[model samples]
Target: MDLSIKGTNFLGYLPSQKGTQTFSTFSCRYQKSNEEVFHQITESELEIALEKASAASEKYALAPIEKRRNFLREIIALLEEHRTLLVQQFSKESSLSEDRGNVELARTQAQIQTYLDFISRKDWNLLHSQELNGVSFEKRLCPIGPVVVFGASNFPFAYSTVGGDVASALAAGNPVIYKANPFHAGLSEMVAGIVLQAAENNDLPDGVFSLVQGNDYWIGETLLKDERVKAVGFTGSVRGGEALLNYAKERKTPIPVFCEMGSLNPVFIFKDAFEGRTKEMVEKLSSAIKNDGGQFCTKPGLLFIEERGSEMFINAMRDEFTSAAAVPLLHPSIYNSFLKLSSVFDRFPVYRVEATAPEYSVYPQLTEMTAKEFSAFPAAKEEVFGPFSIIVKCADESEMKACFETIGGHLAASVWTDQSLSEEWMYLLSSRVGRIIKNGVSTGVAVIDSMHHGGNFPSTSDSRFTAVGKDAIYRFLQPVTLQNFKS
Candidate 1:
């Protein structure tokens, strides 16, 4: 398992560096540029890659399920064999700790295994056959052709190359074109190489998997506009997802863009809940805000509480922030954006912890405002993508319900209460989010069959589908019914 980094695009099984335009991934840990300079995939190369993927889709989709299962197994074995190297590169490129990198690597492997177990089942394709009035009809899931996946910056392994999107797409028998996130191009290339090796070892199609490297927006725009691309998977900011969605719309034939954009993930704490478990709730909330530098899409950005124990919760949170240490973001751009977005709280009442953080790091802060003030302040609702949260105080249950109505869709909304919530509250919360949590933080997403990782409207393009879990494969599959077909 002597894997080496080439810092070039993987056009199927072949490594390409035909483009002169190049960029280097920055080492967030060392605060310096990585040694390898990666060549961007040119328009001509992208076209070739798309052509190969389009051609390969037919064969890959029709290939035996055993071959696909073997492909996934090989990928898992390779990832495990080179786990240490992958974790090291992941840590170097993303500035995340080695332990976090290992966790993400294991998660990535587990995600692939989930898909593997799904496709290995007898009912994997959801096939159905019925005969009525001397007519026979059969229906089953079919691949949607080539899919383009945009890697995310935060989780270099689990959400980036060889991540959930690629795994589910491949498992569903769809060819995948992975666009490497420029911030972690080197690590992405390394993982891409592993996937390509697995494809080659399993004798998969030439264009079954491809990696395109570039930072320019046009690279993604070009991939989205091509007719060969049947679907897309994206994980990033709202602005980036909007751009890709618009690009897909501009295409003569629109395609499904399954994007998991960031969310506010609000937490509602009832008076009783707050007063009863003030210390415990504060600890959980603080950990949620500070974990992974608050880079998770499900990080609780909004905290709603009744005015009765609002002061106590605020005082506890203030102490927690002051004692907490700061952590570095994925990149400088993200760090700058965090600073800019969190600055909106300067006009409001805010408490920030002062820490001598490293370069590209941010301190934890808690901002406060009344429900009336929150409603009046539009900017306060916007997600500040770091270890920052806003506490909204409400006069009573009515005011709290009114405030909840104003919030748009979110990935998940948590309710902390000892007793059951009202039907009205339950309905409102369930309607506004894809997942509802009780007495728990929304930071950790379980990669199980029942997990729904997407949300309504702005949280995701389609709430009906999830970006995680076995159901994610449905995004790359469509149903085809055969009439009067004889087996």
Candidate 2:
């Protein structure tokens, strides 16, 4: 296994050995053609990586703000320089579409560029002071200690090794130790390599960044328990996020954990809205369900459709959802999860069931249930994490209200309404979701400053911070105040 840390240096360590060669192993296997081993980054390597990160934090924090800005700029330039290699590796490992891979590669560069642009503003860390007689106080943002970032499985580029968390932490002047997501471990290593080279070229300390490739929970646990790690950032399933949270809390000095877990992002369609915009909703939603194999955290997995006027819309959706051939999921676990959750949905009295005609052919599956059933069972609201959606027929406004009460915290929601919404309905939905799409699909998340990619409990650890957009940098920054100090 190859581990990268503290510059462009590499360490070769065996996963497990006997006597003097004893070492732990962490292997990542991707599902492309045949399952092939991606990489193994050992425990000893991870310890050394953290040590270097801690050492780097002192210099990185005190380094001129301009140097950090230049470091970020160098990363963006290097990403652009190796755009082809990144896109190729991302596609080859994840089996995502070539054009999509290229777009993601661009998005990665853009994410870093967003941080760079924000960091260059210089006001991010500015101090404000007020003098009263002989007393004066000034406050400014300071970098939290080295941060541990857990990457995303579905989004290797935008949310993985070089994802928003890593970018935001660096932008705020914190050293980042990225735990590579197993689904794209190879890409993570490559991105780490690029950052190390770029950091060395920019004369930044090696401790500013480190990447360790491992698929085990213990790796995350180890990092969370490390006293030197002041904060952690994560994006993945609820179980994974919660495990990291638990690890953090169990530590003697618990640290802050910012986790963005998956959610059952739901879309509600009013009858009047259904009457005027059924076609638009159907087209927009069908693409959302199929795109990225429905692996997105904000994918509209549940729909609250009006009972009276949704027959045509539902029929159109069924055809659209089932017509497309299923692309392979990121791994076999996701595929099996789709199968298991299919059985779970079957346990309920389904209004409709549509899947690819062949048994083992593809992954897209659509199931329907009444509003009453959807509210009755907790499992119905749980995230399936694949190309699966449940349609809940809402007979009236009251049922929709009841449905909203059952909804857990979500990253986003959509209300496709042509007519005015009652204040009650607006209030009900607004309190439960972060980003609300007005009459549009909830899938496409733009990487702009105005976007808020977070939500309430169960959806994310903190609603105040976002995983994407400009506000994300704050997660890695703390504030300090100096009294009676001179400029």
lDDT of 1 by residue, 1-487 (tens): 4568877887887889999998988865677888889999999899889999999999999888999999999999999998888888888888889999988888999999999999999877867989888899888899998999999999899998899999999999999999999999988888888888888888899999999999999899999999999999999999999999999999999889998886899998888886678888999999999988988999999998887866787788989887778787888889889889888779988787665677888788889899999999888778888889999998888888888788778999998889888999888888889999999999889999999999987889899999889999999999998889764
Per-prediction TM-score: 0.97, 0.91
- Give per-residue CA lDDT, model 2, range 118-174, as digits (tens): 878757676586777878877888999899988887888999877899999988888
RMSD of each: 1.3, 4.0
Error of 2 at 459 (Å): 0.9
C-alpha local distance difference test of each model? 0.89, 0.77
lDDT of 1 at 230: 99
How much lDDT does candidate 1 score? 0.89
**How many steric overlaps are in each model, in order?**
0, 1
Residue 360 lDDT (model 2): 26
| TM-score of decoy 2 | 0.91
Off by over 4 Å in 2: 1-39, 347-361
